[model samples]
Target chain A: MIWNEEYETMPRADLRALQLERLQETVERVYARVPYYRQKMEEAGVTPADIKGLDDLRRLPFTTKEDLRQNYPFGLFTVPLDRVVRVHASSGTTGKPTVVGYTKRDIRTWAELMSRTLAAAGVRRGDVVQNAYGYGLFTGGLGAHYGAENLGATVVPISGGQTKRQIQIMRDFGSTVLLSTPSYALNIADVMADLGVDPQKDLKLRVGVFGAEPWSENMREEIERRLGIKAIDIYGLSEVIGPGVAAECLEAQNGLHIFEDHFIPEIVDPTTLEPVADGEAGELVFTTITKEAFPVIRYRTKDICRLITEPCVCGRSFVRMPKITGRTDDMLIIRGVNVFPSQVEHVLMGIKGVEPHYQIVVDRQGTMDTMEVQVEVSEAVFSDEIKHLERLAQQIQRDIKDLLGVSCTVRLVEPKSIQRSEGKAKRVIDKRQL
Target chain B: MQLEQIAIFLENKAGRLAEITQILAEHGINIRAMSLADTADFGILRLIVNDTDRACQVLRDAGFTVGRTEVVVVAVPDRPGGLASVLNTLTEAELNVEYMYAFSQKSGDTGLLIFRIEDLDRARSVLQAAGHRLLSGEEVSAL
Candidate 1:
């Protein structure tokens, strides 16, 4: 069901008008309060007055992750420290994390949006939610926790890790809804098998909200079959309000409905930084219209997806986006062929006897680029005859070639050889740089 | 009789074989016979050890993919035509040997040949009917 009927079911014309008004106000607030945005606007030769309506949003300067990094801690905050009630940061593996702050009103707004997200996924007041997202700087754990609580649901703020304990809690607590990354959900299913718990018979999970990392449809099938739940794709990043920016409603499950009133969504050509036509895949960009402490204007998300303005069966008037195909940064160009790791993952997960744990190693062989996919096989499959193993490898190579149009060597490794990740699984290793 | 053999999955990289041998040495597990079948990227190291359980456990604990398969060990005379005679008998019986490896004992005129056949039971009965000595797991371990 659409959580907030007033805003969610607003007419298209009315939604656009509301978005235009908030967009103008956000532009003016950031221009006046944050110097970074002011300098950027001045450099682009555009003022808040220049923004006539939603149509003129293109004329303003684009905000990027680099800009947030340059501002570092508190330089991008629109309000004084006293007004900021909560803060969350991205992991930022390489350097400083992109920091975001929420005022009391902002937190309340976040809770409301998260409640909307959970409701779209069929979460109700009485459903027990066992949130498995990490709680610290990552923004996934507490973000889902607050949303479940806001929905008046029983919230288990267990966070991540301790696989055995997670399964026990899930069984004992009778959690009906689960929230975590799709990979972690699969890991939990694997652990359940080890602990002799039948997820289908023993556990009470009915719905799963999975997100944070891009996953394929094959993974969705795996999660559903193993856990006996309707695996719903929830999309969000720490940069964009954390886990509630958009979600797929259970009614359609076609595309994620962007909460347009809070965040205006845009699709843009990554290279030219110009808006792409609706229904065409491109980089996803967002502009927070109602954020009080951290307001972003035309922030490029770097995630690639298409915006579906088509009316969803769920009756939410907000624009919907399909599952993210790949991020601009995750695209690998080998032998002049663009290959996303997700495509490889789709092929690998579809095959039998192979686990989802895999690594794509790209290297320079003489003057040519070589891509090798190292996948792990189950112990039962690994113990097969040499000819059988060879056939399996050849089958993977042929499938990848047929699907992705890129020829890659497939190597079957032993079970438990590939490293298991606690958060986002690392899928690629490029040796060309070295 | 069926003899236990441990097969290990090893990446076709330098020092991988050395690592396995070193681990076996540290555990005081004597390697009676071994064979390596390899492709471009990986290899399978099939081994007959004095203590199959201990060797398999140690290697598996060290994160190696170890599997046990029952193989037939036929004792051949320590002569040039000893293996040829055994192959001739198997060829006449229409039995296929998947893989085989051999090693001679220092104190005997007999060599132990490990054969991985598609039909272990049939091959073992056929060899026994032909009066060929098929070593037991205990006999191979004692070697």
Candidate 2:
């Protein structure tokens, strides 16, 4: 099931040599074509000639989201506007969207990578793919659409929303593969239950390629159990050629294999901006070597994860990265203690009767920080006697403290009280002024 | 005999109780006896209704968390110490009543008490042995 076995199963030594050559060409091309990159390279006292091999990637200046925003639309493109065939942007809530452009060849590369991603997740030619990612501006929708088509699979361009219709289409169309955010996949499963449609018996969804947001393993179990599909994690960003950067192969669910032949990934200590040893958790950085229209030299993804060069059982020689545990931006400093919303989610998922719907509210109380986790309980647990309910709340508090090492108040709300999201579930609400 | 009581979970907010009762009224289901236990955040509305299955269905369809529990309904005299006498007998039999509520017939000199005990069958036999009359679902609905 290794898609494009020529590249996916390339020997490690050969892949490294290919990565080095691409990295050198990308650094030289960006330095010569884009003044912004030239300025950054000069400021770092590093020239294109300095990038001799793949290990020299650390010598290149890191490009961040802020850098992309500063450049805005088309400023970072190596090719002219006429050559850029497609434009997609990430929705930034407060400012202009992080824009990305793809040349005709770049688009083809993206489609090929997505095809590889889908095949890795067990998607085959002629299988029906129901793409539920949001289209327009966001890369997830169209990115997955073209990839499904490129993979020779039937594409149902059913973008996100219309939850009821989404379910109906899945049944009537006999979709075997689903493409969407992990949270939305769970939402679809919930809607299926509401419609009395048995996912296992009534639907044809055998595998799901879910990404665009960080999710825990517990969520994977929940989605798989509810939707009766094998949930596979696919990782990418609009900044780095959209949803086909890396994907978890069906044979080894341990980590996602980065498509190393196209995008070279590195782990770095966020604070020091230095590369971390392989297998150590750190911030993830991607260098799009083959991108032409908009080539990022060394883009800081801000996602925290570890890179695993360990050979996968799936026969693909590509390096694998574990699921993102958290983002540097999502880290909260409460009373000098660092906490991530994913940590709290991990704790809540272990406790019974507590639905995955939860919100972490952090506020300041006279120089001291207070954290409160508001979670929803199932109907059966919510209807229990008062003392039992109180005990459940206390147990959650104890578990969070024991697991996360942070003391937080636990509030058990009634079912459906918490607002559910169609995309990324908002898990944190920090009211601290700082 | 065992009687079925419907329990609905209601958030402790204004008009919640009215909402449930309105749904029941629209369904033509009459509430025979009821008791509400509440905390600061929520409440459980337990009721002895004329139609258990229909009431539960309508309320659940309206998005309410509703469940049913079995209880023993006894006919106690309206005179003083009547409920106390029944409680004393149950105490002698070591049967614990989890919860209880009462209602009276307009013309009768007797009050009906709905008792949710640990064991419905054991409570019925113990109460009947002490000359207490237990009301069945049919008898309670007719009243």
Q: Once superposed on the true structure, which residue ranges of model 2 sit more than 4 Å away at CA?
A: A331-434, B1-143
TM-score of each candidate?
0.61, 0.60
- For candidate 2, lDDT tens digit of each residue in A144-237? 9988899899999999879899999999999999998876787788778889999989998899999876667887998899999899999888
DockQ computed for model 2 against the true two-chain complex using alpha carbons: 0.13
Instruction: Count backbone overlaps in model 2.
Output: 0
Model 1, range A39-150, lDDT digits (tens) per residue? 9999999999998878898888888877887888789999999999888986332234579998999888888989999999999999999999878767788888888899
| Residue clash pairs of candidate 2 | none
For model 1 the local lDDT of residue A198 reads 95
TM for candidate 2 is: 0.60
Cα lDDT, all candidates? 0.85, 0.84
The DockQ scores of all candidates, in the order shown, are: 0.22, 0.13
Give me the candidate number with maximum TM-score.
Answer: 1
| CAPRI-style quality class for the chain A–B interface of candidate 1 | incorrect
